[model samples]
Target: MATFGVLVFPGSNCDHDAYHALKHVMNSEVKFLWHKDTDLSGIDFLIVPGGFSYGDYLRSGAIARFSPVMQEVVRFAEKGGPVMGICNGFQILLEAGLIPGAMMHNEKLQFVCKNVYIRTESTDSIYTSGLEKGQILDIPVSHGEGNYFIEQDGLKSLQDNDQILFRYCNEQGELTEEANFNGSVDHIAGIVNKQRNVLGMMPHPERAMEKLLGSEDGKPIFESILNSLSVA
Candidate 1:
């Protein structure tokens, strides 16, 4: 079985959700490691789950980036290991300097929670392999600061590199301005690192793993990573 490590930080509310979703849906061995731990060898992949780390005190993920575990996460990413962040996890990745751009407060200045429709923009990522290009997936989102921001040149570089893996859209799967939950630039909802292994997105794919939760689109994402690891 593929060994997956989920980082656990103080105030992380989504660790169990991610553990259950990945363990059950992927049938993979999921281990929870404290944010203060250093070594991460033997783990095939890493996931930074969502929640208010450090009570989100000094910025969403600012303090957590300094955690002992993140040092290893940064090293792992440099070694080509697949890493991912979701919701607050995304903020951490930004603060960790794992991916380009930064997450800021919602342009509307309100916490948005709903089933967001995101179209798969790229499948080159290890996490989006099961998704077809242009396919629409309904994922639930709950966060206050998810507005993905980047300078114009940086945005162009990301687009030119195909780093954008998913884009927010409407019910018809049409990219619209209003459907942009956090006013992310260019409607980008998800993105991967230059190596295409590190992924960050605002939508909670774990939360959508069960029908009882109002959606099941999250399964494919976890499956994608697991499948990739299986093949590896």
Candidate 2:
């Protein structure tokens, strides 16, 4: 089994949720990596879960970016280690420069919490390897600042490199303005780094691991990561 490390920050409420999903639901070994911890020994994968790190002070993830463990996370990612950031974690990745683009307040200027549909834009990354491109996942997104923005050139690069992994979509997997829950550019919901080893997304895949919790669409993401490492 692949070993997973879930980072825990002071305001990281979803760390436990990620732990439960990987350790219990997915039946994988899981550990908690404290924010102050700089070591990542024996960890096969790292997950930065959703929550207001540093209480979202001075902007979401702005303070948490300098956490002791984050330094290691950046290094780990640079070395081609698999890393994922969800919701507030996504913000942290942006601040860490591990992922491209910036997150802005939802265009509606309000906090959003609800289930949404997202279509897999590419399966080239380990995170989406177990799924087919264009697959639609029913996941929940809860955040105040999830509107992803980037310069036109960066957008072109993402498009050219197939870095876009997921995009908000309607139930039928259609990209529509009404389905753009957060007004993200190109309805983007998730993306991978240039190396495709790091990913940042706003949806709570951990919260969707169980069908009883709403949907099991998130399970494939974990399975894909585990399966990829096992192959390697």
Candidate 3:
């Protein structure tokens, strides 16, 4: 079985959520990599789970990006290992320059926590290998600074390279402004790195692993990771 590592920052509240989703729900091997640790020995896949890391000080992920383990994470991703960052984890990836784009406060300048629909824009990344193009997923997003922005050139680059993976959309899978709760540029909710081994997204797939909690749309994302690794 492939072993997954969930990074734990000082204030990472979602580490356990990722762990439970992977270990209990998916029946996969999961381990926690503390912020202070520099070694990443046995982890096959790495997840930078969400939460107010470092109390979201200075910036959402500014402090957490400087964590000791991030060095290894950067190295891991550079070596083509799969690394996924969700919500605050996404912020960290931005702060660490793992992916292009900057995060801003919600368009309403308020903390938004609710279920939202996102359309799968691309299935070229490791996390979405099992999903189909234009698939609509019901996932929950809870963040104040989830708005994603990029310069015109950067946006064009992402578009040209097929890096954009998920876009906020209506239940009917329409990319309407009403579905853009965070007002991210082009309704982008998730994106992958140039190599496609790293993914950064605002939605919390870990929170949507079970139908009892809300939706099971998040299961396929995990399954995709496992399936991709097995194929490799």
What is the alpha-carbon lDDT for the whole of candidate 1?
0.90
Candidate 3 structure quality by residue, lDDT tens digits, 46-96:
999999999999999999988899999999999999899999999999999
- Least lDDT summed over 10 consecutive residues: which range in candidate 2? 208-217
**Global fold similarity of model 3 (TM-score):** 0.99
lDDT of 2 by residue, 1-232 (tens): 6799999999999999999999899899999999999999999999999998889999899999999999999999999999999999999999999999999999998899999999999999999999998999999999999999999999999999999999999999999999997899999999999999999999999999998878999999989988898998
Residue 188 in model 1: lDDT: 83
Taken over the whole model, the C-alpha lDDT of each candidate is: 0.90, 0.95, 0.95
Worst 10 residues of 3 by lDDT: 121-130
lDDT of 2: 0.95
Report clashes for each candidate as comma-separated counts: 0, 0, 0
> TM-score of predicted model 1?
0.97
Task: Point out where model 3 deviates above 4 Å.
Answer: none
Error of 3 at 11 (Å): 0.6
Looking at model 1, residue 61 earns an lDDT score of: 97
Better of 1 and 2 by TM-score: 2
Model 2: how far is 218 from its true place, Å? 0.4
Residue pairs in clash, model 3: none
